[model samples]
Target: MADYSQSPLELLLANQQKGYVGIHVEQGVPVLDRDLNLLQDLISATVRAVISRYVGNGAAAGANGFAVQALPTGQNGQDFLIAAGDAGGPGSALVGGVEVVIPAAVTYRSQPGLPALTAPTAAQPDPRTDTVYLDVSLAEVDGTVDAELNNSRDVGVQTSVRLKPVWVVRVSEGDAVPAPPSGHSFYPLASLLRPRGVATLEAAMIGDLRQRRLTVSDMERRMSLMERTLLLPAFTAPAPGQPQFVPKSGVIGQPITLNGSNFAVAPVTVRFGDLPAKIVGGASSTQVVARVPGGLTPGGVSAAVRITVSNLGGAVISDDTFTADPAPAFAEPTTQFSPGNGTPGTQVTLNGFNFNAAGTQVRFAAVAATVVGVPTATRMVVQVPAGLVPAGSTNADVKITVTNPAGSIVSDDPFRAELNIPAPTFATTPPQFFPKSGVAGQQPIILNGNNFNFAPVTVKFETFTAVIIGTPSATQISVRVPAGMTPPGTTKDLKLSVTTAGGTATSTDIFTING
Candidate 1:
């Protein structure tokens, strides 16, 4: 009764033309093979063949999950349908753009609010995880309808096999510990040290003996000196055979220079590695020139000098690498220092080689700092600022940026800091102060307030007639009456006031003070 006159493909296409994605392959007939093995094989083979033919690849080698599956029917017979997939045809040779969707309600384990992935605590599983099932179907062509669907199948008509990753697990008793193999002993330290007469207490005794080999006072002094002798950044020595080399024959026995500012100068020794280079005297932060030892090899070299200052600790700073040219020139600039980096004061130094030239002056922004020595092309020393540049990023441009420039002319990224540079507000509680009755320049006269902003602010004390001296900072002020102030009786009334950049604050009170 069904149209047996057409081929199966024609019938399938005819049904597809009617907009039917799936048609009854077997209608009203009970499938005795409930094992589903034969049905699965048939579906798989059909899908694989169709996909392969359309893809022009001779087989569905690259296709993944290319298959069709049977669905359960309401009647005694079974029903089946294809899922979402691309039908490869002449125009579209690739069976691509296939997707299947199924939704289910299930529970899943999730992770949340973990500090780190390495150590994660288990969270409660949510039962509302979405479960979507996807199945693939093969695609074919219908004459004018554009596309047709078919159940995919394998060539051999075999059920498709699935591969799952498996994890191998090992189980053991909770307290079971694995034994160390071969030469490794259960107690490694005891086995190694005991035979050498170094058991715990014995080892402590050996340590004590080794320690006692040196006199405590000598060790302590040496260590104390060594500890105090840390190298500051400004010290760098000169190399041989470089510029500023003096003729050794004339002053060959003369000292090589140690050029730097803010250096610790004392008795010094110049050396290469552990080997002493030479010994010559007269050391200062500006110059530590020692004669280069004769009979030195000609090659790259690293040398250092250790200086022990009087009362202060010894300082050891290193020299840069240089070639040893038999000929040497010596030039050193004077150490000039003023103040900078909020350092209260600044100092500069010139040491080692090429001592003289011309055209030098030290400039710092709108401020002028004094030069220490005669300005020379090789050596120019200048001072820095005493007051700090305003807080925030500040640019410090040096005057005489050229002559023997240790740093760049346009100094970039010079300084940055956070400063609470207040607009200078004056504050005080009980803003008036006076000494006890009859007390002159007496005790316990103080003004207290806040917002000092860590700056040294001068407080000008004044009465309408003459100016007075208040304390010199933002937070608090205390002043002693000048030695000459005639008091009325033992106590006298005086006016008190405070002034700042922001404005002046006055307490209109006559205070009684001990004269």
Candidate 2:
């Protein structure tokens, strides 16, 4: 016969006194105290109130599973017990008038490996453990368990018993489970349990356990420690005293120093916009020297320029602080005219660095010359302007200037312009013929002139032509009169003429031809 003299709480306390079972406490007092009726009423009212909010529907509420055992206090105040049914299986009962499903067996393990359940059998020749694999599958929200567990009545019950799934291992008797031939030793049933999902659940439970004992300050301290250990590279705005590139602005190809923190020893790349700057010397954690890339434009007036540093971790870009100034310099002229001399209408090519084709201006002395075509950054073609230097101007040392938006530069060497001489002309005083006149078929007569070109010369007498016999000098030429040059009259007046590459010249004095 059942003894109804003592209540369930009294029985539990008596059992605990006998060392048969344990008793839970709250604030140093047994949870199930002499006021058993009040404790029951509190539990019943809390459960009923929680379910009333979800009544009318078949939805389950209150604790996940409930039992009448004296659970340890602060083990998770929300965790309830599970009751046994009449058939010794999971019971379908209304605790505090709230329906609940008490699983047949509820267990949990917090360690890495599961325990041995069964002794070795002859047929199996391996250890086997009976396990009730609970899939406890829940839809994840926001990739975290917080949303799924938030305001949900499914609270985890703290239990010392390990609840790992059944693992069937084939091993010899009295020997430990042999190491797996390859891969991992634990081979689980895919359909029964998802290893990845289980791992995620385990991680979440560990976080929850940690959170239970941690205060707000403790959590903050732990977060700070994690941030320190991460060692993520950071780039801050350059300050006054910090190590940074000198001369924030410079021309392309100019060397600049970079001072900062957290730079790698090797494999570091510095960039100006998309163009890579040439690194100079070695780089340490806090300093680097690099030359500005030539890819930058002469006048960076349109867009901002950003400098970037890239290493093993990642890349960091600086604010648009650096500038690229134009640096137009003279390399050399294309034509190898010595002393940099050229005549009018002569095409002169100037080659130098940072020459803007469209914006560059080439000057001979103070006069701007005609640019042949669109000049390149390094080369330019221009024609010397007419009368740039006077015919006999001794001041031939004129400056050859090149100007652009960035700046202007003059040639280090001087350019010379020479004087131009006139063509040949004849003198009028000298008698054109040695004799008074030359008869037809007579000896040759000598003609005189000035400014004659150094080429073959031809002489003529009136309408009759003369034949040149010897080489002609700049002042004299010898020629024979034609046979029919004389007229029927006794004498005739005829003029003599001389022709050369320079030009044709006629003697002012006439000669008399005899019949």
TM-score of each: 0.19, 0.31
Model 2 C-alpha lDDT per residue in residues 1-515, reported as the tens digit of each score? 11233554455445445644222346876543334433443454445545434332121222222222222444422122223343556533332223434446332332225452233345542222221221111111321323443334455422111112222212122332334431122211111111221211121121110011123354455567655434323445567666356768887567877766566534688998888988988877777778877646643232247778877455677753677766656653433223366667777777665676347777887888888877666677788776665542423567688887777777776677543433556666766557657688777677666755445456778767788867776677677877676557788887777766556777778788888
lDDT (C-alpha, whole model) for all candidates:
0.33, 0.52
Q: When superposed on Cα atoms, how far off is each prediction in RMSD?
A: 29.5, 30.2
What alpha-carbon RMSD in Å does predicted model 2 have with respect to the real structure? 30.2
Clashes of 1: 46
Give lDDT for model 2: 0.52
Model 1, range 196-304, lDDT digits (tens) per residue?
Answer: 2211212111111011112234446556764555433234345554422223222223455555543433344554333455544555665555555432322212223
Q: Pick the candidate with the highest TM-score.
A: 2
